[model samples]
Target: MDQAREDWSPHSAHWGAFSARWNGATLDIRPYEEDPAPSSILQNFTTAMRHKARILRPMVRKAWLDRSARSERTFDQKFVACPWDEVLDLLANELSRIRTEYGAAAVYGGSYGWSSAGRFHHAQSQVHRFLNMAFGGYVRSVNSYSAGASAVILPHVLGGYEDVSRRNVTWDQVAEHTDTVLAFGGMALKNSDVASGGISRHIERDAMQKAARRGAVFYGIAPLRDDLPEEAGARWLPIRVGTDVALMLALAHTLLVENLWDSAFVARYCTGFDIFERYLLGRDDNTPKDAAWAAGITGIPAATIVDLARRLPRGRTLITVSHSLQRAQYGEQPVWMGAVLAAMLGQIGLPGGGYNYALGALGHTGRRFNAVPIPTLSQGKNGTSEFIPVARVADMLLNPGESFEYNGRSMRYPDIKLVYWAGGNPFHHHQDINRLRRAFNVPQTIVVHESAWTPMAKFADIVLPATMTLERDDIGAAGTDPRLIAMRRAMDPVGEARDDFDIFAALSRRLGVEQAFTEGRDTRQWLAHLYEPTRKALAEAGCDAPDFEEFWERGELALPSAPDDGGFLRAFRNDPLNNKLPTPSGKIEIYSKAIAGFGYDDCPPHPAWLPSTEPPDARRPLMLIANQPATRLHSQLDFGAYSQSKKIAGREPVRLNPVDAARRGIADGDIVRLFNDRGACLAAAAITDDVMPGVVQLSTGAWYDPEPGAAEHPLCVHGNPNVLTRDIGTSRIAQGCCGQVTVVECEKYTGALPAIHAFDPPEQD
Candidate 1:
């Protein structure tokens, strides 16, 4: 399949590359033949383009249309359809008024860049560029909800986030030389189903199978049995939730007591090991972090811990940490301590042996880097500097002007009057859905560009219908993927829906900055401009560099990949002084002095075990694991056939251990209600021993459908785990999201079931 058929057009998605064709009745999708493992998420494309939930035209809330006051905002309001010209005029006027009355800082340009795989029509770049170049600067956000803790802490401890995680070790190296893989948080394949940009092929499953066939042992240190794929045949440890640091500390203590640690490597390649040694030996805490001490906390036997520690061969072990570990309270410690353990083993730079943060977390990781550059749309320079951590959206809206700390800087939340969001749904990603709903009610003007009737679109004062990926033509490229695809348009735009770029271009014209925003280029011309850099780089690298037209005709171009050897870490290990790390000490910091100067009690100078704030309460005994969903990407196209097929009784499934289910008299397919202090949600019970006792696994990404009521804590009928998750930060320093683990209690539902309207369109006036 060198080239797609005449009727089919090539395209790419976050999941993988595919060819699609419209036959007047159905849209046919064919996965790329090169992809060894295609994601079932591709099933979302069959009925998604013309789903009933698609937003047909520009809509304005009736209450906001009557009066643009915050008091007029409510979830029960009706939407009034208006012409594109009228809605654009209203949008331009509101933006101008907000900028003149308050400042450009009062406008928050929000986008998460997941709307499309096409670089030219990327919603984030379009919105940010329009705001920055046309409307002056706007307030922005920093960091993501997934790797917030590690993204802040890694630069201080080792290196940049990508350097340590994506570019450090290769899966090919693991298949060749690794002996033991200690997965702190089990590397589930579901987490690797989709990458941020587009991925041509998924290799985690094949790589893990190869490594297992080479006689490498894998240890899954999580409560779920299926966290590690079936091909790996990993032994499950089933540790207690949020107690990973205790077990890691015990491993280090055992290495110290038995003299198995590499002393020379620690002294030369690492800093502050002696200071950390005192704490490991109980000189400062007098508790002696031994196997027995960790056994009580993690529920693993002391003998098992000791034997596992002894089995790890120095210079032959790879320590992999999943993103799940650093998405909880005191999340930074587990990531930091995993690096410390790898440093102790003296395997930071060896082939197939080292610390790979978030190795199996996404599809793009653990793969070789591209030899040539990829296409990227340049977002013009921002105008304002005021920003907050991405997970602090609720706090920023609720407490404007309140001071907060992040990394090392202290800043205040901006007094935002207008929120322009595109490409993302905060209702799905943000914690405590009820709190986020209140935050959405605070702003004077809320505008959004949506393709479907998500909760974000329903809450917006103005909703502009945006086009789906299949309705637009652009170029698709990813940083790690080797394929550069020409995303040809497969279908016409539905109703009055427009591309985000065209929508922003229209607004730019209304604001009298169309020249600067558009650069005299339409969507097709912009795609060519964005692809030029990649073409030049490929030509320079001696690869085939076809022009945009030729490449478009060919459908896809193959990019060369770099060697599978270790990257910068290899050079740093080869020459410590010349190729030093980006950290302050130029070496791995087991104990960071700069962090100690912050004087935060929650996050100490070094990685230490901190008791969770939400301890075991008799009222809420079960620990809820709010993880990512396997059916679809975060609440996108939840009405599709693939996502809908996984539902039981028209609701998301919640996995509970047979032990916990029996105690509560729950059975498979039984509707159950999960309640905590924050909120409650109803889910279908799936009783199985795959999950451990006293734990329940309910995935996120269910469309947020709350029962209409005046109750402060309304029950979500769609089983959205974020409704019950707390909206607190991991600590003051990082301010990362700690919504992964929470305490909750579940009971079989005997009351009448509430109808779910999450996928339905809102009422139109």
Candidate 2:
């Protein structure tokens, strides 16, 4: 018989349609007709589906099973295969013991973002639901790695997180009305390609193309040229690292001095501007934030800075700030200052105007779609509410009783005995891998549900093999996206792997809460249950939607597009009093009194120029930027052929300026060692002027592979940038990660290179 072809969508933000050709036992995937140009993310679907690193069965760490032979070699340890019943029983017993002894607060649910895009199989929601139902509850986390700073600070400044995600002006509006788009940190095209929960239409690239065609002049204010799209005709301004806030302040100051400040707008819809103006001038501080001062700090010419500031008010403008700016020291400033600058331009609610925290950072930004909230597995109210900032996993593990300030509240870290992780990988997201590894050893028991033998899985006490999205039936709909795609099971589960729902259901049965967990429904029944609401929503919107059975058979449903509203902030701008923001002032808080009440010295009331905490030692003058990878989604398919093809000499590629390369006697393709006070990593040098001098670009998400016990500088064989990144928080107020605050010295490696073992499985005794 001919192979059965089934339509399905993978778990990504740039949701491309695909046809899975199933030949009895195996599956072959190809892009559907709708996906005009399949990206590298689409090409690697098969490789991710059939990688060698996939975990086949339940694995128990030998050291944990045999108490007598405990070794410190966590990464090098062997795993012994165990049956599903035994593993489930062991997990249930341990969880019960922990609850009985240490209480439910001792169990930490360590699931981050980057799981299956399917609404049904969302790993974080599923795990939380299971824990909430079976056990009392688990300590959870807030915010995400992408925009942790904005998640906390934006609420004080612009009312809520929606100002960044839902309220930002659409690209279509920009193309139609805006004349200039100044992208600070630039439009990260690669980062925007993939999103969580699956993308129905990958129109970000096309959106940029349209905007460019409509005569919107794009200017990239970043250290690298490749940060912006080549097709957008972006004029690059190689700004110095960690100096964006200084540049923004100078622009604001210039606007004030040149009589270009929107006094009427500020007087009507802003607060604490007088105090900010004093600081911008030389009244509060001895030094003025003038064009000259900004030029010295940002490396951009004074003329350029003044010209840009003046030009912004002449036409419809949008200041696009990437999330990376806030992943550094004083991370909140850039986000805050970007808004202040936009407010000063008096175009906060105008079409193609205002500040965008993440314009093209993800797939769903600024898309005109219906506001239907996708239903997720209900995580019942927790008996105990103990949580930490998302990026502080290592801190929580290491410091049990330590108190830290977060969003104007003092939060104490709970002593966690059991860590139940599913879906997300903390090893990839958390900084300072070596420190995190040490912290990982503190938990009494660590359980992980993973498809592949990632670093997180290898370190777990019990590793439960979970099926990938391809091997499961699911429904995918991104936030506010009109299209709903069916994720049909392409093939049977690999080996003894199971879906998260099945695994959690079986565990719930052992825990005596099986009915509560499953709600008297199997996988198929649950999928149909979830689809009913969506069908109802489509019908209400006057769009034809098939029944559950018909929808399952058809495989995809595209809802009619919603009418394009002017700008996301149009309602608020039209009537400030009636459609008031949820903030205390009911207007834009340029200087947040709420934040000031927190008394955080690092993060002040207003955006201020604070030098980064990099060592001033001349030997380590270069600033290392650990950016997002272009090949794969945060260590997801690093072993795939598409991702592997980007590897230079079996190591991550590090981009360096020609001047820096010449100064260090390093050439393109040369094996280089990047070192600082924290740790060392290896990478193949790519000599180019794409990066500014005294700066280097090493994309993060490389699987961390450290040499066993070389104390002085344990070699990171796989070029993971986390080896050198700081694990400190952005500020005492926000308490987000300062992952980008890294300074390192790079030189050509002249020693024998260590074999890359991060991709390979551990040896079995």
Candidate 3:
């Protein structure tokens, strides 16, 4: 759709004409670089972005535009549309007031889906910078869009985000080098920011195929899909969703019992292997579960488990882990265990041997992990009171008397009275969406910055209209890719919206701390200051040919190189100390010394498996796995031409297996009520054999619309799944899964739905 149509001089654009195009109507297009963007002001932020330009090679033009465009956008004709001035003023005042009243800590930053093409000007950095500027300091976020599970798991596992994204393996080499590609989450193919980087893999895939034809084995361990081809012998393991940790435990037990583990590698590159092995053997009965036991639950034959476990690409085994497991109870554990499984295979520093979040995040910088020391922003940072690991949000909220130790101190829950949020819709996150609504009601003031009526926005005491990249400029620095691009404007403010950076920058100005946001010349000057570290690197290679200055003129900037890549790997191996992991032990923590101080010895130093949410009521049968659809990012698919594409053949329906359907007397296309003890939702059911017998699946992204009689709309539930499906208990306290595992039964709908149903018909013209 034409998002702009400004009357600029013909000479404005590098292209011949600035003639506007159209989606449904001609949008105002301008000479994108006129306005100066500013710093972001969300209390704390972790959002990640899309794009078109000469920066991309022509070999993938359409794919690049399709992948990157609309990293930032607006909800069309929904909610109250306001003029820019009113919107900006109201939005800014509300945010400023909220921060003053509640303190920056009360605010949460969020933006799950990716939006920008240029790596730097994307969500997390831009949003966080804005939030940090406005509120002094907001809670910092960790993890990338993909391996969020690993993010939570690895901090304790490999150490931190800097460690994981910093891995040296080019995982695509797996399909070519490994004899067996044991995988999980076949249901998820694309990485969260997969297409945004302009990396396509058909050519690479062909190479993988040639390697596969020469006798490579690929096993996709996930809930659905026999979709893997026969040539690759891609066997789909039917481990029930939320039960993955159990399966991993079983596999680990088998590997240990059969002595399939690489004992030599265990000693050389990893620590705590001896301790993990002892725990798995269950010298303690706390581990009531084992491989033979896991076999019964996972439904894969015990022999197959043994075979796959033993055959997992022995010297060159490539274990690919998925981020989805973290969406369930014990979310962090599985990814932890998955990484351990790879380490046990002894493949970390080897070619074609390692754990892949996916193929493309291979940082191209060719930078070394370090012969160099990391810079510390703080000297002796104390007094940032301890908190629970981020994955344990539910525990922080609902677990009675639950407390966690952080930074050498045990802390009780603070009486959080206010919530000031910018850049995120919590409805798409945390969990038990309905439960959260009531939880949110506890806050005295809820302030949010938004461009649309996001589910999280509905609960706000004040809604601020935030900019959509077009209204203001941003100097973004994405951690995912090694690029630092400028976000120049393409259109004027659509309505009351102003860029988040401007809102925060101006708010800081009002609060009498101009220097807080000041480096402090102007947005343009700030960009130059931010790029100071990379200038020499970019200059030396001529890769900075289109230097940031030139790139900024065109609404983008390219970086010189990444901090680590393939070459970095070989060089680091030659000198392990210079390339060693950034862990306390400076080696893979088959056993983390950090946890010994924390007192959770039962939890292995390496990845140890635990059961899914325990106390599973035998009466409540099937597992509910919330999966992502490629069509949309989180709950963001609404309000664009993209909306029309999400419908399966036109409309989406909750999918369940036929057997599970028959038991409940549910039929196809039936508007049935799906309810559990927590809450209820009425959705159309499409029973399919594609799903596991004991599992049901729903694709998230529908704009949550609440029932009409709802005393008040739960902005989080405008189609919010959480309203009816939230946790009564913080089951997956640390491993994630705050959203999955609700037991709901189906019933025919008796109530009337609005013109647009909570689950609407597939959007179309």
Highest lDDT among the candidates is held by which one? 1
Q: Compared with the true structure, what per-residue lDDT tens digits does model 2 show for residues 1-765?
A: 223446443333333556565654344666655754456676556556656788988999988888687665378888889899999998899888988999889989878757777788878888899888866788899898778888888888887776566556887787678788988888877877776676655666676777888888899999988888887888899998889999999999999999998999888888989888888997867889999999999999999999999999998899888888999878989999999999999988888887777888876677776645454656776777999998888999999999998988898999998899998777778888889888898998899999988889989989999998877888877765666777777767777999999999998998899999899999989988888887888787777878988987777777665666744356668888787767788888998898789898998898788898774369788989898888888887787777888999889999999999998899899999998878899999999888988889999888888776646457898899998888988888777877865899999999988898887777665
How many residue pairs clash in model 2? 3
Q: For each candidate in turn, give its C-alpha RMSD to the true structure in angstroms.
A: 2.2, 2.1, 9.9
User: What are the per-residue Cα lDDT tens digits for candidate 3 across 1-765?
Assistant: 325344332111111112122222423333224212111111001111111100110011111123244121112112343344554465466567666776665554544434433333344455555555666555443343334445545656665554444455543455456777766765233232233322211123343466578687777777776333344557677776666667777777777777777777667667788787777777766653566777777777778777777776455776666556655545566667777777777676566666654332222211223221111111112222323444344445444245654433465554454455655556665556555656665554455666555555544544555545433454444333333435454444544455555555665576555565544656556556555555555555555445457656653444433443444334434556777656677667777777666565334445666565442455556566655544444554354344444343233467788988888777787655555666655456777887888777666666565554554323222233555454522222233344645565555555654344433311111
lDDT of each: 0.89, 0.82, 0.50
Global fold similarity of model 3 (TM-score) = 0.76
How many angstroms is residue 656 displaced in model 3 relative to the true structure, after the best TM-score fit? 1.7
**What's the C-alpha lDDT at position 256 in model 2?**
94
Model 1 Cα lDDT, one tens digit per residue, 641-709: 899999999999999999999999998999999998899999999998999999999998899888987
TM-score of 2: 0.97
* Winner by lDDT between candidate 3 and candidate 1: 1
